[model samples]
Target: MTMTVRDLRPGVRADFEGFARVRHLALPFYLVTPDSLVYDLAHAHPASHFRPLVAEEDGEIVGTAQVGIVHDSPEPGQGYVNVYVHPERTGRGAGTALVRAAEEHLAGVGATKLFAWVLDEPGNRAFAERHGYRGSRSAHFLRLDLTNGTLPPRPPLPAGVELRTGADFADDPRPVFELDSETMSDEPSDIDYEFTDYEAWLEGTWHHPLFSPELTSIAVADGRPVAFSAARTDGGTRYGTVMTGTARAFRGRGLAKLAKADSLQRAREAGLTEAFTGNDARNGPMIAVNKWFGYEICATEVRYVRELG
Candidate 1:
């Protein structure tokens, strides 16, 4: 089989579907489709220099890599090259070729450091180590059988607090965006991200095809969105929480739990059978909350970093 690595033509519909296929096979939780992939590439910030790479074996795409500079990071020259190969297509050297192409692309674009998320499996970890990447931090993907699993009862809302769907903020999503920005700033990670671009958020997140506004739950405290559980759907029985966080001032309260519970309950009611979420291994608080909701770790990934030229 002849394997070659090249840039994915965003204008090509097949490229979008192939990329989404590889990602869905490699990372089962994250909901993605051709529409979402095209939307992401179209809305990606120019500063990011985002280039999607694909590996083709005999005219069939088997692997993909999303390579880009972390333009929003406080530290410059930081970039990322996340590679994913179709599970059935492994051992064909597609991953290696794609990684080489992505690394070269980022390095040529002035990247001084590169990060990649590698599944915690032994083979995946060994592959990253072979590419000079060292494990930095780890995170877990959790799953809950919403149809069969019982969710804890919703906690009573605090005084002056209200529960609302993300759709309720359709007229002015700035509050939810602001709340998300604040909570995301405090999220545990190796990169220090600065999310000051609300327009970018709207383009990449709010308007994304899979974002389920009706399924997302927000906790409003005194007319302000204090906590939220943003949801994404696979347009089927699968549902996932893309982001769940509480504002700094709102931590220690049960708002996050309340929001997640409300979201999960509604998802099940809407016929969603499988629920997925993620949590940083070091984030004990959030992990505890997920556990309380009966979510179990289904897979883990480690962020691998390497200093580049």
Candidate 2:
């Protein structure tokens, strides 16, 4: 009957499990795990000021929010507060409480602009709008039934091109880091990002518990990675493509599609049953490639922005 929002207790296993559970129920298309949650809290860049919040109702977590500033962006004072309430716990006011707490933290930290992602459902959009958030860009969550669907046959590699797994770079992951940095800069997003810190990338992504180096596919040209499809699994049957892109010089050659296809195939062979990925609605090329691979639009989320006064 009573609801309260507070910061998650980092060392508490129940807190992490509850946060991950609510997130999974709210956004099943994405991978969420207790270990990943803990890693994020412990390894976030200091400037990010990351704070994970949970809404408790009678000692049970019903909603969660990941609040932080985009510290790495060239622009300052930009913050994010993504809130997700359990699917079964809607209409309980937990979401509003979490958002209010998140906004207060961001405002105190001098964030001028705050962004959140709301599922495209009418009620979800209404909730954001009622909180003074305006819808902006949108993205699609795609799903492929790897266990039941047929994947495209792996295409022959172009001359002088070779395929490799992220595992191949275990001794030296700087090449994958460079490729990720270059491709990420070109991703379509409302917030512009710069992946400048290799050490940060290693701590935040490369060594994350969910990241699957053995299943990540890379396209190598002249012995350098030009395209890649990074994979992440929930330590279960569900596998997701965290990032898949081709470098600027290799964009039109279908290298991204090739690499991702290989990654998916590898995932299937590795016993992954479900595959999930997300794409910006305006990213036509990537969307087309996903469609070519028989991915269906499972869900959509609209980015919403609210200015702090």
Candidate 3:
């Protein structure tokens, strides 16, 4: 059978479902839903030229690629094309085909630098190396059993600090956006990002179907958000912390830990049984915080870079 690469029809339920299925099979630690998939496709920035591609064999999706330029970055000509093939469907050229198509699109749009994440395994690393991708930073995915595991008791908030939920920002989320941008600016990564586009953030993140505002915890200081833990739920037992960080001024105060612990406790109270999150391997502080919360390293992935100019 021959495998072919083509653009994904996000409006097509089968296409979104197939992409989510492959992604879930390959990366089961994270939460993904059809609604989230559709929302991402529909609300992505027009300037980024976002394109989702899928590899098919005999009418079955075997791989997927999310190709787009990093429009929000200060640098130009930067692009990303994350490729994930069904674990059971490897060695069939689906991955290679998807990468080739993604590269062509990114290059056509003037992307001189391309990056992808490859699972840190022999075969996966070999595939990326064969395609001229060089290994870079790595990250770890952590999981916790909210139902049976013991979590730290909710710590008392320091004076002048209060814990709040995302729902509290229903009338005006701009403050939360500012806090997120401030914390995200210091996040370790190869790519530098700026969250100046509030409308885009509203569509791409705040209103995302997977986002559980009720479970998201924010630490407030003098009526301002200092740290937060963004929560995402799959409408089931699985809950994920998409981002947990503190502002630069609040780093040494342990506000991030407070926000994350509060969020996880809220997740358990909301009946979520499983919790998942990922942290860069180099982020020792965050990793330690997660460990303190009884989360264990479940899997790891490596970032790979390739130039297509």
Candidate 4:
């Protein structure tokens, strides 16, 4: 069975399902659903030129890639192509085919730089190095066994601090949007992102199929959101923290940890058996918070960069 890469068929249910399946198996820490995949394809900003592709072998999708230019960046020619091959299907040509196709698409769009994330395992890193990519920053995947772990019991809310669920802001999520934007801007990343487009956030995040507003915790102070831990569910037993952060003013007050704990407990009560989150290796405060939640380091991936002509 020969492996081949092609554009994802957004209109085909099976195609999108297969794509989401491969991504979940490859990066179990993140949440992906067929609906979310289709929404991303259909609602992405025109400037992004975002294209998702899949590598198929014997009618099975064994690899996936998200290829696009970094349209939001102030600098031009920056692009990204994060590819993941099914863990059980490595050693095949699927990964290479996906990479080649993504590179060609990005280069055609005049993207002069490409970024990717490879597992920190020796073989994965070596494959990236062999493909003309250089290693850079790393991030970790953390997992907590909600079915058999001792989570920190919810504590008393601090003076002047109140806990709320993201669903509380269903009437208007702009406050949450503003809070998210403030925290995201300070996050460590190769690409600088500015969340100036509220409409885009609404379509891409607020209404995302996987977003679990009921399980998402927010800490409000004086009626303003100061910290948050966003939740995404697989609509099954899996729960993932999509983003956990606190405004600069709220850092070190244990507000982020409190929010995460609240979210985790809500997820558990909702029958979620497993929890997963990703953290940049250098983020000590957030790492400590996850550690407090009894999360263990499950895997690591290093970011890689390639200069495209």
**Can you list the residue pairs that collide in candidate 1?**
none
Q: Which pairs clash in model 3?
A: none
Per-residue error for 203 in candidate 2, Å, reads: 0.7
Lowest lDDT sum, 10 consecutive residues, model 2, at 150-159
User: Residue by residue across 1-309, what tens digits does model 2's lDDT show?
Assistant: 989999999799999999999999999999989999999999989899899999999999999999999998998999999999988889999999999889888999889999999999999999999999999999999999999997888888989889999999999999999999999998999898999999999998899999999999999997799999999999989999999998888889989999999999989999999999999999998999999998999999999999988
Measured with C-alpha atoms, the lDDT of residue 117 in candidate 1 is 94
State the lDDT of candidate 1 residue by residue for 234-293, as single tens digits: 788999998999999878888999999999999999999999999999999999999999
Cα lDDT tens digits for candidate 4, 1-309: 888889998699998999989898888788788988998899888888899999999889899999998876778989999989899999898888989999998888899999998889998998899899999999999999998999889867999999999899999999999999999988988888878889888888889888989899999997899999999988889999989889988788889888999999988888899999999999888888899899999999999999875
Roughly what TM-score does model 3 have, to 2 decimal places? 0.98
Q: Please list the residue runs of candidate 1 whose C-alpha ends up more than 4 Å from where it truly belongs after superposition.
A: none
For 1-309, candidate 3 gives per-residue lDDT tens digits of 989999988568999999999999998997987778888888888999999999999999999999999999999999998999999899999999999999999999989999898888999999999999999999999999999999999888899999999999989999999999888888899999998989988988899999989999999997799999999999889999999988888778989999999999989988999999999999999999999999999999999998764
Query: In candidate 2, how many Å is residue 298 off?
Result: 0.4
Global CA lDDT computed for model 2: 0.94
lDDT of 1: 0.92
lDDT of each: 0.92, 0.94, 0.92, 0.90
**Distance from true location, Cα of 239 in model 4, Å:** 0.8
lDDT of 3: 0.92
Task: Report the Cα lDDT for residue 172, model 3.
Answer: 97
